[model samples]
Target: MRRLRPEPLTPEAFAPFGTVIEADPASAIGINAGFTTRFHALAEVEVEGGAPILSIFRGRPRPLVIDMLERHPSGTQAFVPLGGRPWLAVCAQAPGAPLRAFLARGDQGAQYARGAWHFPLLTLAAQDFLVVDRAAPERNVELADLAEPAQVALDG
Candidate 1:
């Protein structure tokens, strides 16, 4: 099995796949009578033929083994953790390409670009995530099995 060590998730490092959703002070705007700091437009939501829908995903901790990856060809998928718990985001440029794993902070979120290959949510604990994605009747998911499973190392 292949071994992968996840790097810290940053906007620059994760740019190729999609945008990283986080509260960046550089992009902050004060609103609501200057009481709330709004981090607006952190990510762009894309949809080809479906409407965007909001859903909550309750993810549970699982083994750090990756055997396959999936993608949404019709729209972008975003995951924002409701519980403050660190998680992993596994992505690749394409099928059969080398995978990139990111250690996302509890306050951070990820928006996978359309057609980008990524593993399903890898939560460190049982947590709830607010998901933004497309809702349509047509099939949108495409799965590809890796030639060899990859084992993820949690330690830095």
Candidate 2:
């Protein structure tokens, strides 16, 4: 098997899945810093369900990686990144069609496109993050056990 050196996370590359999870400060107001706002509503994007749409995705800081992988016994696999800066990575699928990544300076939170592949979560200097993405729920669902516990990473 080949190992992918972590690249910058982008929605273009992770399009096979879903939208990259991003947190707009303007949308963040009363969120508890020490608390988690559980996701009760099935947070989802209905538009990009057919084609791929990869781009920047961000979210809040949590100690764990989100459920962003589906066992699509068929089709391609997608991956995103999770960190406080601009970063891109091909976490799951084979890198090709030429993949690219980048991160904004001083950003924050952990992100995972519904089924986007990504390195668990990273806080190089602080609890900030960005997530790469992709998804195909119809093909598979996350199980109590890691369906594919792959080790994801990055450098620089």
| Candidate with the greatest lDDT versus the true structure | 1
**Candidate 2 wrongly placed segments (more than 4 Å):** 1-3, 21-90, 93-105, 108-111, 128-156
lDDT of 1 at 69: 98
lDDT at position 89, candidate 2: 32
> How would you encode candidate 1's per-residue C-alpha lDDT over 18-90 as one tens digit per residue?
9899999988999999999999889889999889999999999999999999999999999999998999999
- TM-score per model over all chains: 0.97, 0.32
Local distance difference test, each candidate:
0.95, 0.36
Worst 10 residues of 1 by lDDT: 147-156
Off by over 4 Å in 1: none
- Mind giving the per-residue lDDT tens digits that candidate 2 earns over 25-121? 4345444674755333222432234433455434434432322433332222322334434433323442222222333234322233444443333
